[model samples]
Target: MKPAGSLALLALLLAGCSAGSGLTTGALLGDDKPAAPVNDAPARAFQVGTASARAVKCGFNFDPAKLKTNYLAYEKQQPSGQDTAKIERIYDVSFNGVAKAVAGEGEYCSETKTKTIKADLGRHLAGDYTPRVVPKEQEEGLFSGMGSGGSAPEYKAKHPMDNSD
Candidate 1:
């Protein structure tokens, strides 16, 4: 459970890495879907930052201050001589309710997993870091044997003589 490996990691990413305001607000407001390494850097950065913040806020003992500063990304309009309005993401940072330190409850991760997540998140927060592309094989390993090729192992074990194809 390295948070950086295996099936669970894929799930975390597929969940839209839902944590930051920049995750969807700008695109939703501007009617433009920003692609990675192109225009979504801010949104991507915010998502990772928010996750670190959440881990710290949730008491996973993640980092420096154990706090998360929420940020909002908004699309602003400016007067221009061009036909189309200029679109950009404006950021707003917040630091309220940080002293409360709400302790996380239930299913705490081991220190190893916590550290792994912290490191992974940190790498993602960097400016020039592109995400590590997980190979298709690794991603499919967990579910590769599910409902395919034959019946469940238990079913075959129960019907010992029923080997007819």
Candidate 2:
């Protein structure tokens, strides 16, 4: 075989080996250094897991084995560079909420819940996180208007006492 063809065969062999034998082409060809970390929104780390977790949670609530163990547990074991622990509490609380909603019952597993689940799951997967704004304690009343143009029309109201003029 030609040299280039031989090299191509070798890479394919290494890729296949990596899948089952844990022998990767990068390690084999001296490119074994770890990849650089990707900095992203904290929510990005959960983008994939949380999507699946929603579906799995339903099955997990009624039958834990059906969805294959817990989301945080299984996902953490994977080689994701992002920290899954940071979002553990979110998954925990959400899962507990699911369980509590159908405690001692199978309503969560019913067809009736499918529409709600689909709508929520669709929104969950459609990725745009807007944090709620909470006013600080020190900040007094009369908040700034939302969006760019903060030009709220000013109006002068005449008080009864002011009409003494």
Using all chains and alpha carbons, the TM-scores for the candidates as numbered come to 0.29, 0.26
Tell me the TM-score of model 1. 0.29
lDDT of 2 by residue, 4-72 (tens): 554454344323322244356874675635422222323332332333444554553333332223444
Tens digit of lDDT per residue, candidate 1, span 76-123?
121322212111111111111111212333433456446545654566
- What is the C-alpha RMSD, rounded to one decimal, of candidate 1? 16.0
| Window of ten residues with lowest summed lDDT in model 1 | 156-165
Give me the runs in candidate 2 sitting further than 4 Å from their true place.
Answer: 1-54, 57-87, 100-103, 109-112, 128-165
Q: Give candidate 1's whole-model lDDT.
A: 0.32
- Give the best candidate by lDDT: 2
Clashes of each: 0, 0
Which residue window of length 10 is worst by lDDT in model 2? 156-165
Q: After superposition, how far is residue 147 of candidate 2 from its true place, in Å?
A: 44
